[model samples]
Target chain A: MNKNSLKILEKNRDPFRSVKLTVGITISIIFIFPIIWMMFVSVKPDGFMTTNPVEWFTPPYTFSNYVDLIMNSLILRWLWNSLIVAVITTILTLVITSLAAFAISQMKFRFKNTIFIFFLLGLMIPGEATIIPLYEIVKSLNMIDSYAGLILPMIASPLGVIILKSFFDGVPREVIESAIMDGCSYLKLFYKIVLPLAKPAMAAIGIFTFIGSWNNFLWPYLSILSETLYTLPVGLPVFNSTYSQAYVQPMTANAIASIPVIVAFLIFEKQIVKGISFTGIKG
Target chain B: MNSKKKAWMQDLRALPFLLPFFIAYLIFTIFPIFKGLEMSLYEWNLVRKLEFVGLENYTEMFQDEFFWDSLWNTTLFVILTTPTMVALALVLALLANLNTKLQTFFRGSFFLPSILSVAVISFLAIFMLQPYNGLVNTVLQLVGINAEPFWMADKTLAWVTIVVVTLWWTVGFNMVLFLAGLQDIPESLYEASEIDGATRWEQFRYITLPQLIPIGRVILLLQILASYKVFAQILLITGGGPGGATRPLIQYIYEVGFTKNNLGYAATMSYALFFILLVLSIIQLRSQRSEGK
Candidate 1:
């Protein structure tokens, strides 16, 4: 490397580094603005959010919105409903999917490939296409306005089984074979060996299920008619409309509703990223 | 007989774990899909008797202007948003992958919006796009671009607002996927490119893009399909209003089915959307496979 060449390299690298830094910082701010704004509005006093030439961050920040939301709104009810539905759905989905994936991946059951293909075909059918019929079924079952209606339908996720099945297939066959040679039953093998080995993939699937169930709008919106039974996403809109006069309070309600999923993501960021990446890879 | 009994018992043991999903699918998914097909052929309100009016609903759907408009709007949205969101996600992922001090913070910040429900985001968007007192208009005025148009009022601007909001909410997830893809790409490739005196652009074009293609295709397909089914944001933000400017097929279907009690017609419209998505996904998958080959 000559002196002139080194100088040119340094110049090029400096500009490249600076451009990268600028772009990175700009994008970070753009992405973070909405959530930060939501939090800001939540703490701001009523009528302050809508002021002309809007104050980005006004003084005399009030925790009254949060206090008001807690005392007045059906937030706790909605959060409890969301939690029950989300948690049950996640656990049920993991169990069913892991078993189905194991069967499809390891067991040579009759029509195994055919059943697997059937599930894959299910992936192509948009939920909107079947929603009307689902409504009818829910009505017929007299399950409307119940958590059973909300959670039961979502328990069967084709994407979950497909992703987990692929992950399970990557588990070395020798481990299974050795377990079988020791007179281990299929159930015992799955519980003792497969479940533990597939923990990362299971965590990924669980996170996906939880986030999806938490954010689900259309299903709960259509099914749950009772205000008392509404989940956060469904309930927040109705709450906002009902309390339209109090702008900051609903904003506070909205912030409170989003906290669980946001906190969940922050804690299990790795699992969330892994789950999203898995979806991208398999799709 | 003992061996056969043992085999049957093992199958029974596996049954408990698999039962929930199968039962859920059979009742909620498979049965409803078939019922939806059946419902499309009938003329009945929730309380009224079903009359066999085969194909009438489908015929009526073709002449429906709202259906056509919604379809067009949805198609336009899918076309506009999918590529831009995927590209932006890829760029963000690349930037995040670079060795820097604020990598984790930047990644976390970008992902923050995705955790909120669409309803909350749309409400905030309504505030931000307020014509007089909104932050966006204020920013535009500061930049000397006075006479900033109302984003959610005009038809075209409404569509643009929906797309931008959707992108902001979704790009983080796709970016995380791309980041994972980038991490999977061996560090030795970049080192080798540097050794060969390859410029960053050349290295990205050759190594990064090629490695990211499979992940890219997945993101593209998911975005296309998901965007086609957008309803919540549209409902919350536009309500398919300002003269139905932002109405998508799903929202239209919801209105027809629940609001108007036109289940038969809504079924027909949903079927049409189903067919369009089916065709597009097949084409996308075929093209992707051929490209890989």
Candidate 2:
């Protein structure tokens, strides 16, 4: 390699590297400090955290906050509700959106463009705007406080279709045509060929939908009147308000709501980042 | 069969696949839009349609002080959060993109808060910003700054708290996007700049900054739209209190519809917000198209 290329290759060994590292680590810690505090405070034994000029580290930590939350509160129930709602929302969104996207991308039909645009119009219509009437519709259908009420409206977002349609479009038409020549029905082709080929896109959509559903607070907060039907995001705030007198138990509940998602995020960090960037750019 | 019949059959074949999503979209999305507009034109309640008020809701919304305050608050939040978020995300992305062994750790720490639910972050904000014993005030006092600022009670401080918590919770996602943009910058450009003896700052100012403009615009507009929708965090953290200084339009709409059972007025306000968003979206689409050329 030439001298310039050699210097560029050695850029990682530049003299300012240590300074960069220090800045990076410091900033990262600053970003993560609140969450760290929440976790530490959750475990601190009562009266230990009450000291002024709050201590970052206090020994004699206990799991009593967690124990109290699990034993006394409906936290587990809320967690269960959140899980079911997010899972169903993700699965249904994928199925419904992908099916529609496949037809729009791969099938020739009258009003195909019109239909695609109809769904795309949803991209402009924010979910917050639709809630008033959506609540009315849900109430009329007697679906308030039910899983369907939570899951169905969420599946209406056009994002999955918008993302997946492009992916479906990229599938080589020759393969599809040859499969059709081999007597494959559209359903069979969709499940046996196109769906498998679209795994990466599907995964991206699945992650987005799952995270969105799990973190959804507004709709559930408005619709769910019964405490039992509350999701984690909905239930935690109510729990906080009801128990505002104490910090430990509430922090424990925050930690409880957080830990699982954090663990999942760590596990799927790459895919999650990729998914978000994709949707953020595309949609 | 005639060609017309065959064409119709081709359309019919796609029907089964399209039906499920369309049905849900219609019932939940398209239907709600028209239904919301319809509701806005009447004196509706949570239970039933009380009367056909005929634009009275819209007229009242125009004159309502709370409506205007909430709308202005939402706009103010968009102004507060969007630029700061875009600029900060760019910095964090640059930092996270540093060629270091701890790259993954940096990325994880920065993005970690984003995975947290709004409630978790809002609760953490409240926990940390307590006037007397909160982490922020305590830390400030430790550093010899003795003012125990009430973060949620004061108008300016409440906005600060909401904006900062929002940045902490969301900037990671934008950082990830910026990182993606940064990575896509061709290595050859940097190498060529190095050969020309350009300093790092020069390289960044000329090549990196110019290259990042498109993604920066995307993040800027996305942040604006997202900030305009800010509700749950403010609602939870301050309850839009200290005299409703931080209440966004969505919170007002929620209160009107659910709290007061005035669905008509609520729906009217929703359409107002929707119209604002629609105009912003059109601007985004226009800019994107022009850039594409």
Candidate 3:
């Protein structure tokens, strides 16, 4: 309350405020630089991309790269493949994970703990570690070069089931009990009570699953040898290799591939953040 | 009697929900893992007759120089990248949490790269790290730091460069997670610390750090496990290197399986990687749980 006290308070605050600002600016620049640079390069004339001294802001911006990518590359097909696979995978993951979570959390069952542990073992096994063996399995099934091959293996993600189960466990047990007591079938109880209460967690799981399936590259690359079945991530490299001289084409393809994810993040930023936080907590 | 029958019926009803995952896991995960273990015992080409060689592949892996080199490279990568990436993510999260102008801009920019598929980021990284006309080298020249090291050319530096690129690509996702964790910590704790004449450092040490420990441990574990399995960037950027310098275990397995047509040896190596990850994750989980207690 005294003048000297107030002055000291302001002085102490000054260092904290300045430090926060400096740190904030420094991190922001580091985070933003690559993305900004990529955008600049995508628009730059082909020859200017590797120019020394890096004239990042100059004009002579060209749409030729975009035009060339659209006209020649299988970029659209790859995008389609990515979209179909991601969407189907997301849907399948949600249904199976939610149902399994429901059974584990609410339904009375013997060996429930044992089954949960079985799924938990999935948490330890990295997908890459299983890739070689899975490749053999896929080949044996003759599912190579198919969307089913990509989507089927991904749907059994143990992480999804675990997250959903944890979420459903936190739901008030009385609600499900009452629903059952009211002569509601188990299916109806799940449809009405559990699904609605589980929305936030479901949204969290959905966004995580969508982003993961979209970004998946290794399995798709190994399994799908046909160019027609290539996803965006896989197809972009092949496009780059074939058109090695045309930097613009691949750059444009990269930019296009980024659009859907960017749009999804912008729309559901909060849910995505929450989902990531959940993983950090449960991880 | 009726109650028992109903319970049985309930269990039966649950079967459909569990069936798909079980079937898929059996076909894709459980069965293949066993099959992989079986294959590791024999030497079989894709089209040729199989030869049972017992633990010969495992023994060969121990003596094989490339196998050891890849394992070492992967371990080094996991060690170098995990801590830096996790620490950088925590710092970025703290920075993003501050009530500053451009908060959204900063968050979005950091996350932008993570959203982009790995192919795009790897391609750009390769282009940027090129020695002669690359953006990084060009900037280094301006700063008067001559003698630019070829990132993917030299053996030692190639692995280091790949690790750096991996950190850049992934740090944002971890940062986003950390930011969410920061948000969950009560603002009143910081206020109470301030009232008690706590400096920012003390506040961070006592209040913030304790709250973040659980999240930090999880992130660290995930990063360690995931980084050990790093393959795509290695494949795309260095193609397992300018002499196997950057080949991680996963890429090694890939080569053994696809290139050499030696599924058995590949399976054995993959199992080795899995065992390492399992032990590491268990250690992390135990330490964190004990710390909590």
B-chain TM-scores per prediction: 0.92, 0.97, 0.92
Cα lDDT of model 1 by residue, B1-293, tens digit: 69778777666765665666678777877887788888899985664437989999988998988889999988888999988998899888878876667888778887878878877888888767877667788878877788978887798888888989988887888898889889889867866777788887787899989998887877788788778888899898888877998788899999898889977777778788878777767766676567662
lDDT of 3 by residue, B1-293 (tens): 69889888878988877877777766876777787788889896665438999999999999999988899988988888988998889888877776656677777766667777889888878766767777788888988899887988898778777877777777878998788778778867866666788887787899888998877887888788788878888889889879887888888888888889988888899888878888877776687567662
The native-contact fraction of candidate 2 is 0.83
Better of 1 and 3 by lDDT: 1
Q: Is candidate 2 or candidate 3 better by lDDT?
A: 2
Worst 10-residue lDDT window for candidate 3 chain B reads: B284-293
DockQ of each: 0.53, 0.72, 0.56
Cα error, residue B213 of model 2, in Å, equals: 0.6
Top of the candidates by lDDT: 2
- Give the Å error, residue B99, model 1: 0.6
lDDT of 3 by residue, A63-158 (tens): 887777777777888999999999999999888878887788788776789998998777666677777778878888889889999998888877
- Better by TM-score, candidate 2 or 1: 2
How many angstroms is residue B137 displaced in model 2 relative to the true structure, after the best TM-score fit? 1.3
Runs with alpha carbons beyond 4 Å of true place in candidate 2: A2-15, A46-48, A52-56, A281-283, B291-293
Task: List native contact recovery per candidate, as a fraction of 1.
Answer: 0.58, 0.83, 0.59
Off by more than 4 A, model 1 = A1-14, A49-54, A243-246, A281-283, B2-14, B142-145, B283-293
Worst 10 residues of 1 chain A by lDDT: A2-11
Give the docking tier of candidate 1.
Answer: medium
